[model samples]
Target: MDFGILGTLEARAEGRRLSIGGRRAQLAMAALLLRPGRVVPVDQLMAVLWEDWPPASARTQVSIVMSGLRRTFRAAGSESEIIETRDAGYRLRSERVRIDTLTAERRVTEARRAMREGRTVEAARGLRAALALWRGPVLGGLDVPGFAAPIRRWEELRWRMAEELAEAELALGHHHEQIGDLTSLVAEAPYNERVRALLMTALARAGRQADALAVYRDGRRVLDEELGLEPGRALRELHAAILRDDPAVGGPDGPARPAPGIRPAQLPQAVASFTGRRAEMDALDSLPPDRDRGSDRHLAICAITGVAGVGKTGLALHWAHRAATQFPDGQLYADLRGSRGEAGGDGPASANVVLQRFLRALGVATADIPDDPEEQAAMYRSLLQGRRMLVVLDDADSAAQVRPLLPGSHACCVVVTSRAPLEELIAHAGARPLPLAPLSRDAASELLRRVAGDALASASPAEIDHLAEHCGRLPLALRTAAARLAARPRPAGDGLPAPRHEASVEALEACGCG
Candidate 1:
């Protein structure tokens, strides 16, 4: 079955259009197509068909709609059954279904590769083909509430693809040809600073410098009035360039981008007062071995899992810094925010966003970055080919979240930290599992001494042991307690500071020692 959800909720098999049922049927079909091959529960279909207040007969209605859809497909003489009825839900078989949206995604992925390899013309054509897949708004003419979010997302992707096309045109010196289309895009998404920049570039390159300046002024007005904002730095810089008639403003060579062969050094600072994880450090050090496995080798992955405040990030950072010399192409790091176990914190990092950042660091132009996650991952892997780089993903939530950010080169090594074991990675991706336990009492005491210095010099062994035990020998809690003790000097009348158990408890609470 050929599914068409990019424009309308329709399906065809063997060049024959299947006559699907009414709005409820369209709603159910759209839901199934959105998640091809995944079983969508009956309740979910009902919810999509009838939003919040699904009637008691909703189940029967859904069954009827599903039956109608299946009968239509059967009449179309599809060789393989497209829809399968699971125990609790219905699923569209991926092998039997070819979605236009997914095909577009694949096309975008190929286009990104072509662009990276300096095939600007082929890249432009591929991007245009992908954008053309969207006949109109997704599920055009559908007013179902369930369709709103996906439509908005697809529309945003379409605009981003257009922006990429504009960039490719500018790179190929088709600036005169792109001015009209870019102007239309600017009118549609006035707040899109990227489109604004592209339009200005096209106009200036086409010998319409005054007109390009006018476009920037119009964008500035729209942004200020509607969003209470000025144009972004890129736009402001482009405007300034046009004002000075800079020759580099819109040359066929295009704007300044990260040059090829430029190495990116993006690793964060290692823990300065880091302490104790000798066994774990040695295991991490073994990830990038000296053995030669020919040209094509698997990427080395190491996952460090442990309870909160068990120093997972500390161990990963310390080891990455130590192994920095092994990866000359540079290191990549991202706090996945997976362990943001607090009342209010940033959400888990998206693999696509991380890939975009990595690509930028590796010298890919920001305007040229693809919006599709698969495309981003493909481009990232292409960039890492034959290069020795270290990728550190900190506080990952799950294996699924970490998978896309991984490079597809044996020369690169990845280290991930998470509270969960991420068994999926270890089981499938051959990631070495390094489960971190809390520090021993001796290590905890030493860490305190290292952090506290003279603050714990006057303290007795018994007192230090008691404090370490009280903090469960967790490095974070121990460091917090020691740092707090050092900062607040409390003399115990005998030329020594008191190692109060109550103060240690307060420190543990402050750090949320789990």
Candidate 2:
């Protein structure tokens, strides 16, 4: 038989739900389930069944309920009695019974172990799985006085697990994603300082400094108005940190330390013959503020999104090279391989692995890097503190994958290129969105002239326009088309042959342009 007390009290045997009994009988069964395989005295059961007072017939009523429970179990196909008869009371046999509360508790234990070990992703996943088993309040619809303590304990456990999950996600730089849940948690637990701190940190990280401070104020008011107490030391300190623009709000260990005179020029080579996007480049150039403090715009991060091969990386690199002199500390770049078919593996690149590589580039000793992604991220942010650097994340998969890679300093600017718009990063991380479309007609013609050269010299403007149209005005396609035109021989003054779709597509695919 499978029994569930995590939500409503329920039992199933032989693929059938067993109608154990009504109020009095359910109270008896709940008492037994609570102490499975243990003997409860007859007097104790009588007291639980009648919180007010027990009559002279209390013992007889208890016996009747026990008998009814045994008959119910037997009818459910149990060869032996589920409740054992003892001189004192009865013991619910646990040998063949499955209890959801026990299973959830075991899962919670495993999740806690994962959390202590700094395996945050695993911890979050495990915690979510454990919480999924809870259908509702433990023993819902059962108002027996005996269940009050156990119900409170289980509900508290659920909230504790939720708090741990929020911490893990925050460490992973999922501040944007955690804001909603954390807000709800804070509302539910008005006096829970930890939950309040978590919500405040998430707001701060997502570039909502004012809002973060407001949350602290609200918490303080709630405490003072309701309990006549001021905010705790931790909450007060967090408020001060947010006010001073301290980057250590949610970071682990402590404030990150700036790297020692390390200047890393990690940008990949700028695309040869790169053309167009002057307005886009200008917008990117203005991302970093002239002062140490950031402007109203979040944290000096810009997400450049476009269709594949639409020159997102080309525009980013071109601008990076031009603005290299602005960032004195250095430039750091990584290709997140947002698309699945790229190098490394079948899935998007791991943020931990990416952080490790970045740490090495920023002058961190290989052996000194922490094994935990959370610690590594903290170290990375700390190392970049107060430095004016430029970070380029190319072809990023998602915001979660990009959050850990963000430097803690406002002086440091990040430019992300991806096929996806990374809306979460834009909305939550305060990233300036610079979406790239296909090049303008004139820009496309100019690119073709620059790349195809003599191959397109005899080709008329209309023909060049046609060729650009055939390539969808995408830079990668235009480049490949230019290469094709440059290779093929044609008579002088002859317009370029209309490009065939199949041959051009095959060549583009063969070269892995996307």
Q: How many backbone clashes does candidate 2 have?
A: 1
RMSD of 1: 11.1
Candidate 2: where is the Cα deviation over 4 Å? 250-514
**lDDT leader:** 1
Query: Whole-model lDDT for model 2 versus the true structure?
Result: 0.82
> Cα miss at 260, model 2 (Å)?
9.8
RMSD of each: 11.1, 19.8
Candidate no. 2 TM-score: 0.50
Candidate 2 Cα RMSD after full superposition onto the native fold (Å): 19.8
Q: Score every model by TM-score.
A: 0.56, 0.50
Tell me how far the alpha carbon of residue 63 in candidate 1 is from the true structure, in angstroms, after superposition.
56
Supply the global lDDT for candidate 1. Answer: 0.83
Which candidate number has the best TM-score? Answer: 1
Q: Pairs clashing in candidate 2?
A: 256-382
Question: What does candidate 1's lDDT look like per residue over 167-231, in tens digits?
Answer: 88887677888989998998888888899889899888777888999999999999899889988
Q: lDDT (0-100) at residue 247 of candidate 2?
A: 43
